[model samples]
Structures are given as C-alpha cells and as structure tokens.
Target: MKDRLASGVSIALLAALVAGTWWAADYAKRAVKEDPPRRLTHEIDSFVEQFVMVRSDEHGMPMTRMEGDRLEHYPDDDSSEVTQFRAVSQRTERPTMTATSQHARMDQDGARVVMRGDVQLRRLAGQGRPELDIRSEEVTLLPDEDVAYTDLPATVVNGTTRIQGRGMRYDNVSRELKVNEQTRVQIVPGSTRPAAPSARQPSKG
Candidate 1:
C-alpha cells in the first residue's frame, strides 16, 4: 500500500510539473505576441558635400541641374535637404529658370523643392518676354512644371516694373504672374532693361 501511494504522489507531481511548464510557456508566448515591434527613429542616413545632381531630357540633354554646399538625406521621410542650394532648369526653347536659397528641402525624386531663407528666383528672357526676378523668404519650386510660388511677402521685378505682394505665383510655360493680397505695382518709365544676357547651356557635373 505504501509503495502504491508513493507511485501515485510521484505521478501527480510529474503531471503538475508538466502542466506548470506548459502554462509558463504559454504565458510567455502570449506576452510576446501582445508586445509591439520597435520602430525606426528619424535620422539622417547619408550626406554629401559640394554635390551636384542633374536630370536629363530624353535627348540626353541636361534639363535641370542642382548643386549645393551640402546635402543630407533622411530615410524616415525619404527627403533630402541642401544647404546653399542652387538649381537651374532649361528646356528646349523654353526660358531658362534659376533658383537659389540658403536652405532647400527636396521631396521624392526631387520633383518638388522647398526653398527657404532669402530665396531668389529668376526666369530669363525668351520668346519676347522680359526677364523676371523674384525675391522672397520662401518659395516652392516645381522644376518639371516650371512653376514657382510663395505665400510669404515677395518682390517681383520684370524689366523696369516692380511688384510687391504677400503671395505670388508664376508659371514659366504661360509666362503668367499673379500676386495675391496687398498687391502693389510700380512701373518705371524706361526701355525694358536690355534683355538679360543669353542663358548659357547648363553643363553636366
């Protein structure tokens, strides 16, 4: 009888141990399943100094050229930023466009660029249109569309004419410029300043 009792107790202990191990394992699995994964932090993954990037046309001609003192890329948003940024766009038979700023942020594939701090934009003379120049604290450029705009106060100069407004939009294709609220126009009587020097073809870097 004592032997049978000992055997029964051993069996019960072994079953309990097995059950406890299974419960612990199950609890651990559940805990792991309930936990969330760690996310990547926003950081710069790459950077370059004195860099230049060019986008070419189907004919292998450089259409848009960009250069800067420094370029940093953020993987979190897939954006690139440049310091002392400069860009030029020249299409076949289209007016040459140029932009410069203290800092610039470029979106995916550089389709859109946001320029800040003493932004300067220029549309050189072409197709009988006078050269257009703009000064602002910020500007957004769409290189492919040949468009630039700003909501901040801006000053635009065309030949002897000067325009000031709080918001401005310019389309190189249509050669249309529009100024929003608080628009001011000043036209100095003079022969449109001699056409701006012919734009030099941008060279690939």
Candidate 2:
C-alpha cells in the first residue's frame, strides 16, 4: 500500500509538470500573436544634398532646373538643414522654397514628406524678378502629385501684389497656387492699373 501510494504521488507530480509546461507555451504563443509588428528604422549618418534638372518635351527643350541642399533622409525621423531649394521653369519663372530651420519627416512608407520650420517660398517672374514670397510654419510635399501645402497662416507677396491667408496649396507640376481662408490681395501703388473705360458718345440731335 505504501509503494502504491508513492507511485500514485509521482504520477500526479509528473502530470502537473506537463500541464504547467503546456500552459506556459500557450501563453507565449498568445502574446506573440497579439503583439504589434515592429517598424524598421534607418538612420542617416551624414548630411547629403541632391540637385536635379528636369527636362520635358512640352518645351521642346529643357524645362526646369532644381537644386537642393543639406538634406538628411532617415527612415522615420525628419531630415535637417534643407536650406536651399529652387526650381526654374522654361519661361524663366523661378520658384524657390527655403527654411532657416528646415526638417522633413517622411512617412514610414516614404510616400510623403512633411516640412516644418521658418519656411519661406518665392516665385520669380520671367525677368528674374521676385514675383511671389510666402512664409509659413509648416508645409507638406506630396511627391506623387508634385504639390505642396500648408495649414498655417501665410503671407504671400508677388511683385506688387501682397496676399495673406490661413492656408495655401501650390502645384509644382502645374504652377498654380490656391489660398484659403481670409485671403486678401493688395496691389502696390504705381503698379499698372486697369485702364478706365471711355465715356459714351453723345446722341445725334
């Protein structure tokens, strides 16, 4: 009877150990399944710059010239010192965007870029004269659409024209600008004004 009781106790202990091991393994599996996947991060060791010149057949010649500087691209964080950026179209229309403290944070998939800081943008006329100047706090650049926009209040100056708005969108590809919310346009004095209409002729007697 003593030997039998000891054998029974040993079997019970073995069964408990097996059950505990199985429970631990199941818990680990559940934890692994519920945990979120990790995102990959790639750090940039040094600053880099890129300069690109774009040409198109529409002009039957070279169309645009672009230069950028002090760009640091990372997988998840923002780049630093994107100091200079300029684009010149075929008609000699040059548009430039720069920042004193520029940083671009890219999406994890690298589909979009968000630019922040003391952002200033300018558009030049065909004569290389400053036509437009824009200041904003934050801007986003969508490469797929070749567009840039900002939600912060902005001041835009184009030659004799000055405008202020709460938000703005610029189409880099189409060369169009749209301003939103409380837009005001002011034309500088001495700028060319529309000609006045002539008085009607007197009726014949």
Q: Native-vs-model 2 lDDT?
A: 0.57
TM-score of 2: 0.49
Model 1 segments more than 4 A misplaced: 1-38, 190-205
Q: Which digits, one per residue and each the tens of the lDDT, describe model 2 over residues 55-147?
A: 444546554444456555554454433445444443333343332225555453333556667766655444444455667888776544456
Candidate 2 regions exceeding 4 Å error are 1-101, 108-111, 127-130, 193-205
Which digits, one per residue and each the tens of the lDDT, describe model 1 over residues 1-205? 9999999999999999999999999998877856467565678889999999998877788889999999999877889999999999888767889999999999978989999999999988767666789999999998878889889999888777677878878887767677775467676766543322211321110
Model 1 TM: 0.73
Q: How accurate is candidate 1 locally (lDDT)?
A: 0.82
Number of the top lDDT candidate = 1
> Lowest summed lDDT over 10 consecutive residues: which window, candidate 1?
196-205
